[model samples]
Target: MDGSEKPPRGSAAHRVEAALLEEIAAGGIAAGERLDETRLAERFGVSRTPIREALSRLAAQGVLESGEGRGMRVAQYSREELAQMFEAMHEIEALCARLASQRLTLLARSQIEVAQAECKAAAEAGDLPRYLRANEEFHLSIYRAIENPYIFEIAADFRRRTGPFRAKKFADAGDLVASAESHDDLLEKIFSANSNIAAEGMRQHMAASFLRVLAAN
Candidate 1:
């Protein structure tokens, strides 16, 4: 299956949670900023019930932490924690690329191309949210190509933890466009069916990405 999330559910709480997560992934919310339920209720045009539910779910996921007076704040990580997470993700992604290149499914190839096109378009349009979503799907296409649920779940979890911090690197359309272009070499190596080439290419790609994120921090 493609990497797109399921169609929006009917539950208001679910919708709010997803929307907030997207904003978090887009770097719209900074760590340690308190979330006010009343303000969120006004922002999402929903009652406090859904907002509270959404906050509770994110808190459970470790994306948020308890704040002053029972409110919640965005989760923060120390530099070392960020480095450890990125290190794990880097190796996981490299392994996925190696396997994906070896096993190159037609469905995954098609999905990857589609996601890349979206990435380019969103980058050109300078839409950070759109670009971030497209970027997620693009990498997910590769992870799915490996056809291993365990690796996929591990990679996705790492992504969930670092998406916001990773997003801080892109400050403008130029940054976004450059990031999208950086995918080209990795895609070529992945399509080559050379495991070593694919893995190394992915490792380099992630190295550069981590450096950018580090600089942003």
Candidate 2:
């Protein structure tokens, strides 16, 4: 799950981080908007110490960066940077799909099925939030089915870093329906146990998504 979705537990810094991440993903804090420590501390009912720690964590995650003067700002992606990131993600995800097509267990396949169903229902109902949630699960199921913790972690981290940009696309119902339909294509390829086909299917899907994001910007 993305840090924002889960119930926050542990230290004050962790809670602050989760809240900030949610705000960033929801676009409440725009790209390149400066984050004041004092303002955030007051907003979250915490102190500067935890707020500082949370900001640092976000910076490390590529969600925030040091600004011109002092504090940090939400990181803005350049067109080239976004293109490059999506290219890498496409290859990584495609490989995962290939591996998953060959390796998925019965339970893993069932989980993917359920996630896809949720996505379809959400899209038909025009529920953006629900569609995004189910979409994450749909992708994660493929990552888990690959049976490689390292690959799963890499995929999860990329998803988290790009969460804000991806969230923007959810506002369009046409895009949401297209995404749900693509998931169906991916599942069909995976279920067929055709590694090459599955990889290509995933690559095509990722490429389409990259274009949508680029167009939106």
Candidate 3:
């Protein structure tokens, strides 16, 4: 099987959680800033229930933390925590790349090409936000291309925890361009269906990415 079958989409609560997480990662929501459920509900144009559910999920994922007076705020990461998280993320993504290289079907390859194209366009246009969004999709395409649901789920979970720092990399235009170039190399290797080379490319990409993020921080 091509593993190109689109996985089932997440629930509304999950969508809301993703939006909030993206905002947090993009620095729209500052660390230690309280997340008022009522305000978030109003802002997202949804009821409190979904917002509460989203907030809870973020908290569980360690993206948010309990605050005084029974409230919650954006979670901050220490250097050690950040390093550990990125290390784990690299392993997870590298494994996905290896599996995907062996299992990718024609359709899966096409999907990844589309994401890489979007990434290139965004990078050329100097659209940091668009590039970052496309970058996320590009990586996700690799994860899904692996055709292993359990692996995808685990990688996704770690992504949520480390995403804020990963997203922070776009703040540097030079880094953004470098990342785009790296994606080109990565896509070429994956499309070649060389599992070892693809995995190595992914590992090197993550190493470079972590260094960039570490420098930025």
lDDT of 3 by residue, 1-217 (tens): 1122221248656678878876765455656779998898888788987777777777877788989887888887887888998889999989999999999999899999999889888888888778767887788889999888999888877765666666766666776677888898988888788999989999998998898778766
- Give the clash count for model 3: 0
Off by over 4 Å in 3: 1-14, 22-33
lDDT of 1 by residue, 99-179 (tens): 999999888999999999999999999998899989988998899999999999788777767877888889889999998
Question: By the TM-score metric, which is better: model 1 or model 3?
Answer: 3
* Candidate maximizing lDDT: 1
The global C-alpha lDDT for each of the candidates, from Candidate 1 onward, is: 0.86, 0.83, 0.80
In what order do the candidates fall by TM-score, top score first?
3, 1, 2
Q: Stretches of candidate 2 above 4 Å error?
A: 1-9, 18-30, 36-45
Distance from true position, residue 86, model 2, in Å?
Answer: 1.1
Cα-based lDDT at residue 19, candidate 1: 81
Candidate 1: residue 211 Cα off by (Å): 1.0
- Comparing 1 with 3 on lDDT, the higher-scoring candidate is 1
Best by TM-score: 3
